[model samples]
Target chain A: MPDLGISVLFKGKNLPRLLGGLWAALRISLISVVISFPLGILLGALMTLKNPFVKAAMRIYLEFIRIMPQMVLLFLFYFGTTRAFGWDLTGETASVIVFVLWGTAEMSDLVRGCLISFPAHQYETSEALGLGKAQLYRYIIIPQAVRRLIPLSVNLVTRMIKTTSLILMIGVVEILKVAQQIIEANRTASPNAAFGVYLAVFFLYFIACWPISMLAQYLERKWG
Target chain B: MDHVTKRFGNHTVLDDISLTVHRGEVIVVIGPSGCGKSTLLRCINALEKIQGGEIKLGNEKIEYGSKRLPSLRQKIGMVFQNYELFPHLTVLGNIQLAPVKVQKRNLAEVQAEAIGWLDRVGLEGRENSYPRELSGGQKQRVAIVRALCMHPEILLFDEVTAALDPEMVREVLDVMLALAAQGRTMLIVTHEMRFARAAADRILFLDGGKIMEDSDPETFFTHPQTERARRFLSTFQFDNIKKL
Candidate 1:
């Protein structure tokens, strides 16, 4: 076997850049998740409105998001929009915007599923209790719906993190992108670096997502 | 209310059903299952849409189409058979939710009132317990208090004891009797004939989605006007009657 570049694992000089790349990836997912959650909830609630026109509009938007792939959506935002509008946009900013849009659509669908899955008698009880719309949501509807949403939202967070890898395609230089650059630069000197670097990348993703996966499992066990 | 007709497709669930409930009266609706008794109760609070009818609560017509339905619902409290308490909230939080959010009462005042209601229902100490933590009877009691905290002018019960264990039924019935004794106007859908006799001022026997008989509990139970009411009474077990 060829000499492996295993020493790269202990190179202190590369530590800061790796950590910085990891932080950037996390920040992109974190801010997008925060912005998406509330926006998704509001839009999901609006989708249930009695008005036919509004409901139709919401349905169209939801279907469009569901049918299209996220990679295409990211490309549309990062490349298509820039080309169409002649705008100057950085890769990180474009990635954040695209991820938030994608996350919002997925989260809203999760919220909608939660809201509609509640037993019909729940709304009847709310009506019977003399609860107004605000009270119905604050008390009966939201409380019950949120319990169901929690596990699903945690699952969505993991998806969002994994999908952040797609940002590397748009030149955001996230962890996978950094790993790719390092491996390519060292391929001539140490061809074995490819396997070790990719393996490290795999561990990085597992480390980032494992806790959220566990959280989803914990919530399901506790609530379901 | 006058000339209320509710239909589902070709079937009429409540056909021109008309009745007047005076202030401070207790009307117990007893019927075979699927006789529209629940639907009628639901109509009073606009939980079910009335295809063609008018419901007047305190001189104001209840409008199913109006955006003001929420406000109108606030005056009518409903207790469900399933005791649909918010599973995520504590017993006290369930009661205080509507009071604080809809009524916009002060949090302290709502909490005090919730505690008072819980005490009345014999659940004063279980305020912090979630619905899942409570027994079926306790959950129903909390549901009742949650409705009562809205301070509605009328209370509607849809088979409140139907879902309880036989042994747990009395605790909930006692709470209802206490509320009735306090002169709360109530409309109840129940299979408990004894409760109808002891607590209800009038009994309305429903069949095929229409009121088959309506009279004082003594007269209605002793001398049912319709054959359907008699058939229904025949199925009631002797042991159930003794318990009542």
Candidate 2:
């Protein structure tokens, strides 16, 4: 009502540009999540192995990922590895790779926690019931662990969506980058374009993440 | 099970124990806490690795890490103190899971057999009920029915009634008594002296990792052979209850 510059979002081609930018961010995170989810589950099952060597190796990998920041990982893949290994990697490709690595580590740890925390009697009961190792995991362990994993996994997806904002630093033309472009281009026409653009971006992120959180809550209430 | 020796680190839980359970024999093992009664049942089921013995079910030796272990386990059903029913599965699912999946039996046939066993244990019409929906006694009966559904050559019950409420104990014990009367071979570990005395064909009184007295229930309960067994049975006697 007080001329808050909300009109910039409805200006020519601006809303569509922001929509395209939101799609870009979503595409990267979705691709990363799709690749990493199964890989994380598999790696998590491996981490629960009783073999000391496998346990130690997975521990080291988990520690390395947790200790290093995701930005450093992105730079390592995008800038450092390209120069050092002489392998050509596009910014989007590099961002996907880095996100996959980080996502896998985080997701696997989540999976491992879900798996190990299962009541020990489940295994013993399955064994006593003559379930083979494979059958036990397939029938008993996974079915139960999945209920706990789903809500936590939804949270992970939301985190990945937000973290895609960091990819703008590496020249990925995602939502934030597109917002900057609009704000710069509209600097003369709309004096308060930055405020409107960023406000729209905030709504965009909220829209992306809110439904997922609601879905998690709904699932928790239903299954819990 | 012969010359079965089980040790955890340097502590020998079952020391140089040899025993045989004939077809349709009901052997009840009772002792003080940590006296290895549960361990004895576990060893026969190959749930525990025995350091020095061979457990033969019929002709096949039940050895640790055997390729045949899974098949061997299928023939031996073990129930625990806690009724470890799979929470995700319904009563019928828990009972039918092993038979249909591991045994690769027809699902319809397995389901019918599971429901039949459920009815025997007074859990009819509970096929769709999850473990949490049932009372403690109902859960234990379901556990027994779950084991019974496997049609094992023998059943090993480790204190199946120990965790139940006073009223709940009878329902589970009644199921076991029914099984025994039907000539099903079983090895039971329990703290319920009355149920032990009622159900045991032969009692193996264990102490300090040894069978201090192995004799008929009448002899073991009323005329215990060893000083340790006499002292053991005395604890169960409520001499003052007669006055009340």
Candidate 3:
């Protein structure tokens, strides 16, 4: 029933700040994904091997990271690393570092699962066709794996984008932080300003993520 | 091969198998399910490594842990029981893949050759279809031509028709016969005794990982040397008698 913050949003420099916050969120996500994907895929491929030492070492790292809470990881990198490692770490740097680690661990498992998910017969058949290990993966195994990998990895990437909202807790001034600031700034001017600001943040996230989620679903149906 | 051996941990899947496959000959291997029939065929291309002894394919004498396997494998093509067509490739894509990728042949030439093979096997119209879109017999036929496209010296068929419908088995065996009629060297592990009799120059009866009997299909089918061979072929004999 009250006037929404559209007038306020369009009237001054507020909208640019909101756009900047979205840019921050996207930048953190893109950087983390770009760095993590290849490392994760390599780690995942290594995990598929039968070597005892490699398996044990990677399993320990994967389990340690997997069970630890993401927020705990954030805090550990932001606060604990400063104390324990004697390092100067900013909120944005820590967020990027923590997200990169988390994304690598998560994406590696997805790659490993999809890599090994093909029927064992495919491997033997490829070998019988005189395909080397590299050629086998490039020609036969990887193409099918890409079908399975894309849907699941896209979901993980989108989840990482949403989880970037947690970076605001460490004070990165992402979209959620920007919304909070707008709500506080208009607390008296528009008593219902919190609702409008939060709603905008919700729509911003949906706009960013809905297409990827739909892509995952479409890929699953087509590939399965 | 002289004394080719394959072991899985302590269990010897192939206990010192020794046999020779002549060029342009169809040697059909027949035995009970766990008698290492498939394993012996797999060892020819070194798909399953031999723990001991040697395999001579063409001029290469393959030993344990030979480095020449990948190149040597180009001389040997295999068709699996499950018809492992590259599920991601279209029928023509599956057929042309090895010729283009492994053989380093021109893609257009390989594609045209693949189309010809597909037509020969009555799969011409299905070139653009995926593996999942084909029937079991059609898939097996495509699998065979995919191997044939590489122009290998020998073709190893590991129960290639085992996973088909009763009606579909004959369709695949007919294609195998066509390959055999062309004087192609073939080592087939199969239970289809009729096809074995119809197409094989020699029949190798394997049992307990040993070549129990290696004789002409006419001799082995009519007068098996070992009791195991007799028992194995008696079922085929019974089926023939039932037809009578």
> lDDT values of the candidates?
0.84, 0.90, 0.86
Error of 1 at A83 (Å): 7.6
Q: Kindly indicate the candidate among 2 and 3 with the higher lDDT.
A: 2
Off by over 4 Å in 1: A1-4, A30-39, A50-98, A138-151, A188-191, A211-224, B51-53, B65-74, B104-113, B237-244
Ranking by lDDT: 2, 3, 1
lDDT of 1 by residue, B27-54 (tens): 9999999999988988887776788879
Q: With candidate 1 superimposed using the best TM-score fit, by how many Å does residue B147's alpha carbon deviate from the native?
A: 3.1
Candidate numbers, best DockQ first, in rank order? 2, 3, 1
- Of the two candidates 2 and 3, the one with more favorable TM-score, higher being better, is 2
- Candidate 3 at B20: error in angstroms? 2.4
How do the residues B16-91 of candidate 2 rate in per-residue lDDT, one tens digit apiece?
9999899999999999999999889888867888999788999999987788999999999989989999998999
Candidate 3 per-residue C-alpha lDDT over A78-139 given as tens digits, one digit per residue, 9 for 90 to 100: 99988999888898899889888888888889888888788888888877777788998788
Looking at model 3, the pairs that clash are none
- Evaluated at residue B7, the lDDT of candidate 2 is 98
lDDT of 3 by residue, B125-180 (tens): 89999999999999999999899998999999999889999999999999999999
A56-141: candidate 1 lDDT, tens digit per residue: 88788778877888789878888988889987778888888877877888887888777888888877776665566676777677
Q: What is the interface RMSD of each candidate, in Å?
A: 1.9, 0.7, 1.0
Best by TM-score: 2
